[model samples]
Target chain A: MKIDLENLTIKKAHEAMKNGGFSARELAQAYLNNIDKDLNAFIVVFDDVLEQADEADKRFKDGTAELLTGIPIAVKNNILIKGKKTTAGSKILENYKATYDATVIKRLKEKGVVFIGGTNLDEFAMGSSTENSAFGVTKNPHDKTRVPGGSSGGSAVAVASNYALVALGSETGGSIRQPASFCGVVGLKSTYGAVSRYGAAALGSSLDQISPLGKNIEDVEIVFDCIKGEDKMDSTSIPDKIYKEAEKDVNENKKIIGIPRHFLKEGIDKEVLENFENSVNKFKELGYKIKEIELPNIEYSLAIYYILMPSEASTNLARYDGMRFGFLKEGENLLGDYMKTKGEGFGKEVRRRIILGTYVLSAGYYDAYYNKAQVLRKMIRKEILKAFENVDAIITPTTPTPAFKIGERTKDPVQMYLADIFTVPANITNIPAISIPSGFVNMDGKELPLGLQIMTPHMQEKLLFKISREVLS
Target chain B: MEIKDIENLAKLSRIELSDDEKKELLGEMDSILGFVEQIQKVETGENVSEAGDLVNVMRSDEDTHESGVFTDDILAEVPKVENGFVKVKKIL
Candidate 1:
């Protein structure tokens, strides 16, 4: 029977697999055939993809198939999949393979999900655009000339362009959601510790979360449910009680959406702002109250994120010494070996963050920069938590603008970082936030997507999904 | 940051940068640090998060074997290995 990979979702695909509409191998092949190699979304399309599909088919035949069974999912390169090449888009580990699967990967495998391939990302998940990838950039499917917002740009494109039914992307700040917004898909950044980070490459450990980007919120929720839970390996992973507390009925009268009017003050593109305003009115028309609120310390989020992210990143990345694993280069001396191997292997953005991280953590400046950022981080979290007291969720534009032309903001790293202004606060507060497609805006005759970001209190993913479904509808 | 500071950081980070990279990085460092310098304005006097809630997590001490798919395949891809040990430059 004919299969339409373009219109397939995990839930739809599951029903088809159960009814034997087509074999999992056939569905996998449909995706493989539809993959546009020029998009450069995938790092490695597993050679044994059909073999995994066949295994998933066996589960369906045996009546053991689950929601994700037989559904091919793409993973961002940073997350480990046992024995597969996991580059994290850096040249340092270009030839390196995972010794063990990430907790999320293991969970999906147990559910009989088929592994499609690993997708490209910003090297070490550092940059806003996938331009930092040591391999070539993954072009935006909407307009090939523009960037597919990143560091999970490839994962976003994989699902956006129908390369995979759904894909996994990790978030340090806005890695997952921003890309999803740019690619016109749904991205969910789960609350920190909601999912185990056992085998994913560490970036900003305090701010990092494994997120899912899908064609819709329902598909993302299905993937998120499979992966989220506490694990012995990740002590920071939250207990299941948090999920229980979050599973509450949607309250229309209690659904007050908070908008920080200050964030929309300047630099946001005109059309993007219009799209956000439209979403606000749509929610208002749907009986959801729109309240204008103030988050006092939010202005300092970008600065705080910059300081904290690099400080944590530099410390976390110290493990990549050339001696043990990754690409190695012989030098005149031991120190020289470290210098040459790292200098040659790491991309520019990674190096920048490392140096910046080292400086902030260095003597004399530590108290002023690192310590102050920590205080501000807590303040930002408290402010967001306080805002949730009166409002069920907070709303903002996912990016200041849609996907900009490639090389537009690369030269100036600060401007590139500004693209994540609205999205970074949720990562700071460890809140569950999602970017769902609001509508599209025309840019130079091309229609680019815009996203309305909804942030709820920590462990309140149910409200986030409830509100996101309303917004998308 | 100055060129001398960049040199010190490069040494600390153990990454060699060419002359051009050093100059380029020096300018970028100045701008980035200047940008993040805004955090100093935050008024965080005496209102820190409670310390008790921030204690380090410790699991019970026990001898347990780890069993997974990990194997010698990871070692096979290393640049240099000898007698099941990764080979590195002389330290002393």
Candidate 2:
């Protein structure tokens, strides 16, 4: 039997596979047939796809199948799977192979899920566009001239183009949700520490969160359930009990969504803002109250993210000293070896961030840039908490504009960072936020997808899912 | 920030950027630093130090001592390993 793979959720795949409608191998092959290699979405397509599918099929026959059993999922290249090349889209680690499965991979493997491949991302998950990837840019499925959004651009594109049923993307300040917005798919930036970061390369330790991108919110939640839990390897991973408490406390009767009107005043594309307004009206039509609230520190989010992310990223990336693993280049001396290997191995954007991070973290500038940003981070969190007191969640356009041309903002680093303005607040405040396809905007006779972003207080994913469903449906 | 500042940072960061790259970095850093200067006006209360609510999580210092767990697999991925140790350029 044939089916629409674009709308096929994990639950539907399970039923189809159980009834012998199609073999897992057939599903896997069907996806492989539709892939366009020029899109450059995947870094590596595992050769053992059929073997993994056969294992999942055995789980079904043995009645040990879980939700993701026999399902083909695409993961960002940063998440490690044992015996696979996890490049993090950088040449430095291009030859490196994982010795152990990341915590998320370990969990998924136990449930008999089939990993189709690792998708392309911005090198070390540093940039807002996939153009920074050493491999190539992942063109948006809607328009080849436009980017898929990044550093999780490939995962978003994979789900948007129906190359994978659902994909896992990691966000270091809007990497997942922004791309999901641009590509016109559903992406969730799981609350900081809500998912394990044990196996993922650290971009910003305080801000990075592994997330899910899917065709819809329900599909995203299904993957979230399979992957969300505390791990011994990640000390920051939150307990299921914290998430459950918020889930149980959700008040279905009085659901008030907050809109920070101050943020919408300037710098947003006209069509994107119109689409955002239409989404707000849709929420109102669904029996939810909408309120305008004040988040005074909202404007500082972008500046704060640049400072904090790079500071942490510099510290995290210091491990790639061309010593134990990854790329190496001998020089005249030890310092020269270190400088030459790094200068050659890393891409342009990665080098810029490393220098920027080092600059901010240096002794004299630390108080001015890094420490101040941390204090403002707390202020942003407090402001969000205050806003939540009056509303169940906050709504905004996921991106100021949708899917700009690949090279549009590459020249200006600050302009590129501005693409993440609306989504970075949730990352700073450690809140669960989801980017659901709001509608489409016409650009030069082509329909580009726009996303409505909803951010709820910490561990409040249930509210995000409920509101996203109301808006999406 | 100037080209000299960029050079200092490049040296500190252990990245051997070319002179052209250093000039480009100086201009970029100048603009970025100018943009982030607005954050200085925020009046954080006295004695606000920690970035977030996170604290160091301590675990007992005892090793369970599982033998032959992942030593071989890890060593296999290292670029240069000699006598079960990862080889690196001499520090001195």
Candidate 3:
């Protein structure tokens, strides 16, 4: 039977397999048939994809098939799948293979999901565009000339271009949401501890969260449910009791959404702003009350992110010395080995962030930059939590603009960082946020997709999914 | 940001940088530092608490995996491994 790759969801795929519409192997093959190399969406399509699907098929025959039994999914390269080449889109780990599965990967394996391949990402999941990837940039499926957004660019492209049913991406700030926005798909950046980070390569330990991107909100939600939970391996993973408590506190249906109008005053593209206004009006039309709330410290989110992210990143990335694993460059002595290995292995953006992190954490400048940013981060989080006391969720344009041309902002790092302005607040506050395809904008005679980001209070993923489905409905 | 500052940071970071790369990093770091400098002006209140609750999560002192169960797999990825141990340059 011919598979409808364009419109397939996890539920639909499972149903089809149960009803004898197609075998899991056939479904997996259909997605494999759609892989386009020029998009650079996948670094390596796993050779055992069909084998995994066949296992799913056997489970179906034995009446033990799970919801994700036959579902094919792409994983961001940072996530480990045991023995697979997990590059994280850096030359440093270009040939490095994961020795064990990430907690999320291990969970999905239990559910019998098909592993499609490892997707591309910015080096160590840094940078706003896939351009930072030493492998190559992942082009936007909508317009090949434009980027697919980064760190999770390849995963976003996988879902958008029908290379997989759904994909996993890791977010540090806007890594997951912005790419999902630009690719016109649904992406979720779960609350910081909602998902375990056991085997995913560390970026900013405080900010990084393994997330899901899918063609629709339901698909994203399904994948999230399968992978999210507390793990003994990841101490930072939130326990089930926290989510249960958060669920109890959530109001049944206030349907109130907060818009930080003061924060959206400048730097947003005109078309994108117009589209956002339309989304807010749509929420109003759907029996939702919209309030223009003030998050006083919200504007400083990107600045705070830049300071804190690098500090964490520099500390996290300090483990890439030559001896144990990954790329090794020998030099005259131990220090030279570290210096040469890192200098040559890491890409330009990775090097820049490391330096920036070192400077921020340095003796003379620590209090002014790093310490101050941490204090302000608390203020921003408090303000957001206060706003949530009145409103169910906060809404914003996922990106300041849509997918930009490949080389457009590569020359200017700050210009690229601005693309994440609206998305970083969610990460900073450790709140659950999602980006859903809102509408489209005509740019340069091509219709580019835009996304609306919805952020809810901590661990309120149920509310986040409910509101997202309503917004997309 | 000066070239000396960039050099110092690179030294602290343990990443080598050439003169040309240092020049490029100098300009880039200047702009990045300039952007992040905005937070310095904001006066956070004296009572600004830490970001989140800090809890110590401790696991029992027990072996989770069998000894040498993963030794081969772990050693396989190492750049140089000898006798089931990762080989490194001599310190002395």
Candidate 4:
């Protein structure tokens, strides 16, 4: 009964529910009561909490409930839930209610998952920390002076602080995994095109992906199974025709994991390096062979990410002009209205990316910037594919450092982007990756949580989950 | 990028950025562009990496759909329709 709704992983709660100890409403009330008090972790807790709880209660009572039945989940503000005010931690759409449920919302609703509320995030998922959010930065629940990692910072804190039993986060350039790492939780960035992007606001469209944030591996897999698969509305969605679960007896096999030898060369914090080595040692103890793999191009992940990401983001965000459905014009002329609305509505980081995106994709620069990034992206993907042939999965640190102060990197955008150093590589190459809390670091007498990131080949999510669940348990 | 330059880019992007926003964005733009510029320095050996691989993603000019689209005729269904469209304001 004393379970902090924020810290309790969904898998533990579900196991308890399956045993018939607590009813659905009881679980829903635990989360709702916390949301009403902890205004720091959540933005807008759902108003119809009771109704969804009642529905879930019915399904559970009749023995027809889904795995997520009666479980309370919080969604990052970027993902749409029907009639919910999904702000994406931005003022431009602060008052805009979602007209339609995102594909993830629709799927979760059908399976008796009760949405508790929307959590805060960096505006458009742009920052390494939540300070870039217009909604005010989401504080690290572990230490208030520090930050929760962003742009999925709120989703991370929701689970870390027990504000919600589990939460959903989107990852583009380490948003989900980094936040999860900072908050000491489980986060997964599904393979590109694995989940439908029907209603989520696009940041860097090419890299933007819907993913899950949970307390642990089992919980992440449950949410992943519920929300994944193709949707007609999302053209990028890949059909779930090729999924296979790794056997529970997978430990007996002499599995090989690739470790980018070059990743250890520069910029990694000592704590990060130590934690990674300890994780590798643990994996070896579990009878897995660690292969020192050469991915020379892996060092260039951030360079490629910024180029392709901004270009795609520039195109994806072009629809939010002041004259259209969301934030629109209120000036003397059409162009004036657009200028004023977007100028006032967007924050500094958002505008910076927009300009960068436009400049790269503009006249006389398309072939040189955009097209060439494509060719390089293929080379990187090919390297990952070749690496997979020698190893079942790739292992790396989720982030280079732990959580820093609120404004530590606000002045330098490159410093912020460096936080994605580890997670972004998996995204650029279209692979499934998970970040699990490995240990905490003592940085000058401060405790910082670190994450061990495990990545599997394209669409090899079951194998990814199998490895993560081992480390998590 | 200068503040003025950022304002111009905002116009091209169709988002209204305020003066304060412009000043702040100018600072951010300098750093983002500075980082992106480093990619220009990284040796790719005659191949530069782009942002996406959807090289030939083609959406054909297929037959027009009949559902969920707002046409002039559909706008006429609203009792407050104006100028053959669903209209709202006349602000100066």
Candidate 4 TM-score, true structure as reference: 0.89
TM-score pick, better of 1 and 4: 1
Tens digits of lDDT, candidate 1, A1-473: 66887778887888888887888899999899989999999989989999999999999888888888888999999999988999999999999988889999999999988888999999999988899999988999999999999999999999999888999999989999999999999999999999999899999999999979999889999999999998878989997876676665445446798999986888899988889989999998889988999998898898889999999999998888888789887789888889999999998999999999999999999989998888888888888888988998899999999999999988898999999998999998899999999889998999999998999887878778878887777
Isolated chain B TM-score per model? 0.75, 0.77, 0.83, 0.51
lDDT, candidate 3, A237-266, per-residue tens: 999887788779766685989999999989
Off by over 4 Å in 4: A1-12, A15-19, A36-39, A244-254, B1-7, B15-27, B41-92
Question: How do the predictions measure up, each by TM-score?
Answer: 0.97, 0.97, 0.98, 0.89
Per-residue CA lDDT of model 3 for B1-92, tens digit only, reads 78888888899999999899999998998899899888878988564554477767887768477777998888889999888778888888
Docking class of 2: medium
| Stretches of candidate 2 exceeding 4 Å from the true structure | B45-47, B50-56, B61-65
List residue ranges in candidate 3 displaced over 4 A: B47-55
- Model 4 per-residue lDDT tens digits across residues B1-92: 56777666777887766577668777776766666565555445565535566553445658667775545433433324456554444545
Q: Chain B in candidate 2 has what TM-score?
A: 0.77
Output the better candidate (1/2) by lDDT. 1
How much does each candidate deviate at the interface, measured as C-alpha RMSD after superposition? 1.5, 1.3, 1.2, 5.2
**Candidate number achieving the greatest lDDT relative to the actual structure:** 3
lDDT of 2 by residue, A1-473 (tens): 56679778988998988888887888888887778998999999999988999988888788888778888899999999999999999999989898888888988888888898999999999988899998889999899999999999999989888888999999989999999999999999988888999999999999889988999888899888878988867888887777687778877765898999998887999999999989988988898899999999889998999999988988898898888788988888889989998999999999999999999999999988888888888888989999899998899999999899989999999899989999899898889999989889999888999998999888878778987887777
